[model samples]
Target: MSELENTFNFSELEDDGLDIAAIFGDTGTAEPLPIPEPEPADAPEDTGESAPEAERSQKQPAPEVEKKDAQADGETDLFAALAAGPKEAAKPARNDQKATGQVSLFDKPPIFSYGGAKDAIEDTSMTFEELRIAKADDFPELAEGKKVSWTVEYGKTTKVIADPKGTTIASIKEEIEKSRAFLDALKKAKEKDRNPDCLVKPKVTAQSKGIAGYKGVFSTVEEAKRSDKTICLIPARDGRVYEFRKTEMGDFIAPKDNVIEFSAVRAGFTPALPLIPRDLMGQIISFFRCFMNEWEEFEALAHIYWDKEQEEYTVFIPRQRVSKARIDADLRGSALPEERYIHYADIHSHNSMAAKFSHTDDQDEKATRLYFVVGHLERFYPSITARMSCGGKYHEIDPSLVLEGIGEEFPADWLEQVERCESRSDTLLRKKDFLHAFAALGDMPEESRL
Candidate 1:
């Protein structure tokens, strides 16, 4: 028997048929190791400096023990590998199961709580009392019998009223009394009803056509004849004409009222005296005399101004700047300085002819200013005529009224003086000449007249 076999109990092992040699890696059917080649002649001698090769060969694994040690080591490595395999993997599942169990047990999500200087507790078995409990250090020190009172009151409100300026208690009371009185009066007024007939207007009309504020249409002859509104035209039934309205009685006779006779009333404008100072009137006369003497032309023109600020009438001898004719005349001057004074009157001469307003004169004196025509210059006392074209009418004013404070060279009654100075009546002579001229023309045929 081998010494190794003698050292261990082999009888029981042999009866069990257990291969002990196999466990120890002693395979009976083993192959021998290769032998080394013999050294050549004349080979180099060994100095024995290196260790023996036998010892190297001895340190190498014996084939019989290699498999045995490998088997034992592999078993141990397998068990250890299993133990080290993904420790984090198994731990997470266990932790998740524990977390889920805790959530389900508490009927709420697992919450982590932190408290002052304490380790975290993840156990689900914690009770509400344990969570609510506080450490001794967390409470504050207090007196044994501290008292407190809290009150809540209801059913009351506060309001702020703004006081008006200049208001007193007496004024406020008076206003309240006035308001009550007004209300009482209004209530009493509502008790009485208004009459519908009282609210209606009366349908009344005036009797006289001349009276205004009446409800009818008719010719107001008396009122029109009395009024200052001059009527230019008056028609007749039998084609007869009358130029004037004569006063027969209290009521007046108009131009068309009397159709039987051919009569004439006031033909031209009625005159109104303008307000002129005595001194200014004299100056105006002197200005005309001087102006006529200066210019011996058939006709001459001049402008006179009334300065309201200075209260004086001044004459302006403007440059003629026109081609004058023997019988008729046209004149132009610079723009009158109306800003300084009113351009009140315009005067011109007719050089020994009759004092009359011409068609050109009508156009020239269109504005509201007094106009004068001086004629009968051959005689010592010349004829003077004054008029104003205002509100669309030639209003003849008395020459005496306009030239009030003049020297006695002019006549007081100029119209009478003009008649007496003439050799014969001009109107009769003109009528005689017109009849002779018509007689010479002979009677026209009826169709020719039409």
Candidate 2:
């Protein structure tokens, strides 16, 4: 403190010779004061307007000022920033996230496995009649009153049983075995004597023949001519063929050669020889009768005629076979018997129209046409009546060809009209042109149309 006072006294003495010690606090008692240096004459004045030289020197350049001004004004210097700005740090990339839950790659759901899915099991507890009754209850329409037989399978042994009295389940099983054996034997015998190209015999009775038998049905005298292969020669009974061609009422002349006849009856006729059990025979007869009745209903709805005595539902189509050989050839690949005439009643059940029936050479295009025709008919006549009355199995006539025939026979514009009436698309055909086309097909046509 004494040194500090002495120094301060000296400094004050040098400055102005004033009483410095009295004006200043004691050095030991108070902190030393900071004295500002006296202003020099050479020092620049600060009027609060001009910035210091050093500060001016450190300020941003004119270009930088302009750039800052531009940025503040929302103007970006993309290129300049790219050249001058600090480079961005590169970021690390990440891989795709995987599913979290535990999963089994090859695990499969459990499925039931049966030891014998289709193999019939033997139940010695029940008799044959009980089994038949059970089966009949299951398929009452097809099996009721129908003789049923059974074959019981025990390990590797099979035992046949007959149910003549329809009494017990055990008897039914025995009959089933007998029936199966009989059928197998018959099948083997037929195979041994089978003829690959043999023609099928017709089913006709003598009572159903002759001009007197077909009296009012024949349109022309020639149609009445009975042939062994023909059912009945009748003119267009329903006038469908006459009307379809747009022919005049009187222009349709009855065809002399147009004959309808069934093939010969099967040779064996005895009740037992037929091999069909009485109960089964009743069922078969009922089934056929129902089929025929339904078929007639269908025909009547379509305005087509069904001649019961003739056993034919005649509808006009463009083509007919000249010989049995031709018919066989046409039906070579068919599932139906080659020589047998397929009844309209059984046609839907057999799904014959939906089947492909063309020869191998034609690329099976006829199947598509057949499907179209069936679909068309189904659409128009959705009812059972439509199915029966639509008539004819594979009329075998091309629609386009029929159109051409109609064009040539009627007014030139008629063909165009027919074309316009054809279905635009199969889906639409069901509701639109189906019934019209079906009715048109049934209409009578001029002779020249064929």
Candidate 3:
């Protein structure tokens, strides 16, 4: 008997998850191990064997013990390979059992959370207006002190691509003007409601008409009216058309009311601030009367000033070269006021002639300023006239516009009842020949305009 067989009993293994079938791999029904003929006690046992068989028996005994030891070592190695199992990849399932192996923590999908830091939450979930109108309490992490310190972004925006010269527009307002757009929309709505569109198109007509070599629409009455056509017709709208006819005096004549058109607008040196305590005109009148002479006439000069620090209108009598007709003063010379004081006007006396601007006055008073002329000093109430010189152009203004105590209060309704009556007059020059730039307001008669 083999010594290894005596040491281990093959039938005494416990069923403790050890795979004996795996250790001893796939022993099929074809074959079992060949046990060599053991060495006989005396001579080799021979029945009717050949002579070669007897020779093999002598060599077999020599290696019989060695063969048993080699087989025992190979079987022992099979038990050691049990834990390693099969080297081939495992099949998916056996007996409908689930396949399982060592699983990684990262193998499963990550669980998203909205309760972490403010930055950890995704911003793509909210829209632009939603972020603008939403409050801090609307967020989960930022609400109820979930985190003491956190940051959120809404007003600012990051560019999808970096640009060096990108610009953003921001609106600024002193007050929250919530209803301005609403008011404009309401006005447009009201206009549309009141005056809906006039869907009917206007009737347009084209005709062949010509006269006096002026082929199209006649600009003048002579062209529009021919020998056969005694009168000219025109499409009339809401306006006045003055008919100027050549009179015997070789002048185109029209009503004075229709010819003269003007409107009142304030210009250089309007009386906005109050005058100083000293009455400058009264002082000038007193000084003129105090130095009145019956011989030749002399002129005096004064300038009106406004002091920024004092916010008052003052008068300074400047030294000048004066005569009966002319008075010249160095306005911007050494006698000029300081930078804080603004020179507003220039006034001079004409001694005794009517308060009218002479040719010399227009030539000398070219600077932009208010000008005043006092005349008829011999009378109890001297005459005064006020005008503004705007860049060499002159405009006559009411004396009360600048001079105090020059007019009296009157009822407003009296203007409607007043009527101007004068004799007929004509000019030697035509209206086109003597035309200058002037504001032409619409024709507003006393009855309708008042």
Candidate 4:
């Protein structure tokens, strides 16, 4: 038993020796290793001697290890990496850690209090009171007791959010006043209902045919002679053709004729004049008396002037004269001729002129001279005149005698003058130069007869 125990003890001692050998091999021959000194937190003190190449190699690893330690502890290695210059990139951040929560300046509750007081309460809920306080605090300067009376947009419509006082109401009233004034001025500018001062009234005349004394207004003598009703002549002051049936109260109104009244005159008025001839005064007086039934009520006189060069006679009846004549003629029983006669000197064949005066439709041997007995009285007495000259001849007067006279021996110069007169007359007629032709006749020499 003792020998077996000695053998066990010897084996254990050998096992212990082998373990010690293994440890020595790993620790580089089993000497006690010296501890390394920690680097100073401050910058290293500079030495006069340059560091050895081996020491520099060792120092490079020291800075890198220190930088890694700093980054692991959440310290920035900005200076260490900057010292590395362009050779190294900045270290990447670690994303495994939980992030710190952010604190917002807007999240806190406001300080203002409103309504009834209550037990202290948490301000986590977004209540109306809490919201109002938050708004006030956000715009502290502008929100201090300053109600939002209205909000005015730069280019859009204004909005009235809160009426702290009557400021908005006052602004609205001012705008309404301006609008009303504008409307008043617009109404004045329209001036819609004003009446015109002047008016037009037409007068008409009625006439009957074969009724000797029946007076009428007719554009032509034949028309006057054909109508059965007592002719009423209503002359138009405006020269427009007015129908008798269209006139209101036409029957009660007396027919107006001869003299034109001042009230009846209008803008662009032109008077109609007679185209016949007689003693200048007699022709005018006769025209007025025949047409004007109220001549006695209005005294009127006709003024006549001869334009010898024009071979025309112009008659002017003044307003005063018309009024006076209306009074005189209306009272007077005798009626004057509405038409007048015009006579030209007989100068054709002297013998034929004499023969024409004696016979009706006389065909004389020397010349074909005609005579005319022209007058307003022709309707009453067709044979009032004996001899009259026309176209350079004398003839027995007839109502329809258009050609006055003819001459077999005309002077050569006289023929030329006649030709010129005929040409001028033709041009005047074509151009509707009635007024000019009348003036031309006056320009002709008295001796130059045609």
Candidate 5:
């Protein structure tokens, strides 16, 4: 017998010889009960005993009525017969149905009534114009002949390309990507814009402000970095302030005052970065290192809070409540405690796969302040990509900037173990090898792992 089958003995149950039939009545098929026969009618009672032959012959028979007279007066005879006494009850009409299970034309089936007075107020259908109006937002479109020009900023009202009539919110969002303004804005340390040109912005005022007063859209870097700031500002009609700088040419022909320096406003508020100690940074690195060799993805959540005694911000690594993990990991919102911390950061490993923020992730973290993606986890130096969403814009920030007191080099053993486990031909075949490597490190337990 196999080790598993031998480990559990089920022979005792069979030896018991349970009597299922006796316990729950006879198991043999039961005979149907016979229907009883109907009772016969009772005989009438005799008045007297049998008489002699002479006495019986003297008895007279009942006089019969004339059939001709009765036939002549059938109506009178029927009345006379009815007045005499009530006759035996006539047999009831046959009530047996055809039993064909098909609906009969003669049958009157019940009908359901689903309408009332309220139904009269409802319209069955709507026109195309009515549908368009119902779906439209408050943004007004420019007239046919009217044309306007506006500069594209990553985090401002200039993010959108056109009004509602010209394009939809989804189409304008595509422009944000094609324009490549998001990366440029990050490089310039500017605000991020959700809407590009062809897509519609979300309904929320904070999300929708990026394209509020947009007229003409400038998406290309060449157009955005145009030397002539006056032209870009002229179309916007905003009171934009600018500065002039002296070029190689002397002030005689082209003066410094003629040049424009900048024509945009800075953000009003920016999220503060937390101070992560070297120990916490190492802990976070170690936590992310667990999935370096695995083909699947894993995620972690870090809560940042102010340490009252230390007078510095500390990083709190909470238990990851991951809803799902494969190519991408979705961390459960319930894992994050509401009252404990006002600021939190979500970090996830991408397992050397897709490194960019997916559309789903963008929607999920649109309001998050700090988010990081660790890719190429099996490499010597892991790939770290971090972005901060604040003031209605996303800005790319370096890990070194936020993660302080951390050296570039990681432990040699960590990299070796990751590489060795990832070298397996089939990840499923070497699950034990991966587990043993982490177990040897003694950083976490098997039950607590992803």
Candidate 6:
């Protein structure tokens, strides 16, 4: 034995199933075996004792660990694997989509990458006058009037160019790119000018969703009335489309009149601005009664204008011909600048009658304005009703929406002043004292009736 072999017992390592001679020999000709990995318990928990002490302690090997020919066979198996040639990787299972040729739909030319050729197409069925043209400097590659190929990517116009590499668009200068983007937007807008696809179409849902789909939209009322869609939408001229609906009584494209649904539980009118002052409302009522007659009714017209600078409302009485039944006013408006004093409401008196909108009032109040009617002028407490009219349609609104409201505030101490007795007014403001004296007209003397 050599001095190195004699230095320590290698028989202990061989007992652990490792061949000492085979592993240390030169690997120039024969392939070296891969050493088998040790299992748990071969190197037990650390103890202060040495290897010889551990053998004396009688430590047991784990179950299923055959510390014999199993290691020898595993070592041979690893060497045999290295000596053999590499096997091909397993092919993935086919999904059988090739039979239907659907794979071609996902296939693309190796060079085209941004998107498919489908993105290059645009519906040019309707075209307006050329809104924009590529500037000469921005597009030096494009000829003035010759046909050119271009597409909008993320809304920016990009021109196809040939390159030494795969197909790609040439990089534009920063300034030129911005200019092209502006022109691209204009071009797209012009394309959608009269296109039906670009026009908003009303959608049908389980429940009514306002005008988005309830009415067919159009550029004009005339267009809406002539539309073939079941419902239509017309631009409200305020960036939103007007809701025009089809009615069974024939005006399919009629201007929709919204109702201020009166609810006993919920608030019907939520005020958007301050109410008209009580002093101004009193002036309107007193002036309206000036032309009141017991036998005949006279309708007087006046416009309520708002001065934004002063933030107060002023009445503008137009020159008119007044009679027992009607008043014809020259409503061409005065020399007032509309920019400052906006005519917000048109109010008229129904004299001694109940507050209501008449046919003549509806016909004349076609312009968009708030309309008011002062009725029961002969009574101590007159009635005033308010409504809004727009595009020849009317919407009844709570009079308190704009008016300062009825009744005056009494002194807070007046509540304590209420004694046992309270005197009632005999002015017959509401139903009159006739109910107490007489049930019907025949119950009263002929001379006692008005």
Best by lDDT: 6
lDDT of 1 by residue, 60-133 (tens): 43444433433323212212322344222122233344433321111122232223233332332443223223
lDDT (0-100) at residue 21 of candidate 2? 20
**Candidate 1 TM-score versus the reference:** 0.30
RMSD of each: 51.1, 42.0, 32.6, 42.7, 34.9, 25.3
lDDT of 1 at 290: 54
Q: List the candidate 6 regions with Cα displacement exceeding 4 Å.
A: 1-272, 293-297, 333-335, 407-450
TM-scores of all predicted structures: 0.30, 0.16, 0.32, 0.11, 0.28, 0.35
List lDDT for all candidates, in order.
0.44, 0.29, 0.47, 0.33, 0.41, 0.51
The true-structure Cα RMSD of candidate 1 reads 51.1
Query: What does candidate 4's lDDT look like per residue over 1-450, in tens digits?
Result: 332222223224334332211111121222232334566555545755466854564454455444444333333333243344312312121111112132111111222222222122234233322333444554443243333223321111222324333233223322322343422332233223111111111111232234235444556434543565454344556554322221334433333443322234432212133333445534533453353342222223343333454556555443332332121123243222224422222111111012123343233212322232222221332122434333435534432232223225757786565533467768868777778787898999988747
Candidate 4 whole-model C-alpha lDDT, 0 to 1 = 0.33
* TM-score top scorer: 6
* Model 5, C-alpha of 369: deviation from truth (Å): 1.2
User: For model 4, what is the error of residue 356's alpha carbon versus the real structure, in angstroms, after optimal superposition?
Assistant: 9.9
Error of 3 at 242 (Å): 22
Clash pairs (backbone) in predicted model 3: none
Clashes of each: 1, 46, 0, 43, 13, 11
Candidate 2 residue lDDT tens string, 139-171:
443243343334443212344444434444333
| lDDT at residue 35 of model 4 (Cα atoms) | 33
lDDT of 4 at 376: 28
Q: In candidate 6, what are the lDDT values of residues 276-394, reduced to their tens digit?
A: 78898788778877786656667788878888899878888888888756788875746368888877888888888888888888888888778898888888988888888767778
- lDDT (Cα, 0-100) at 182 in candidate 1: 28
Q: Which 10 successive residues of model 2 have the least lDDT summed?
A: 88-97
| Candidate 2 stretches greater than 4 Å from native | 1-124, 164-450
What is candidate 5's TM-score against the reference? 0.28
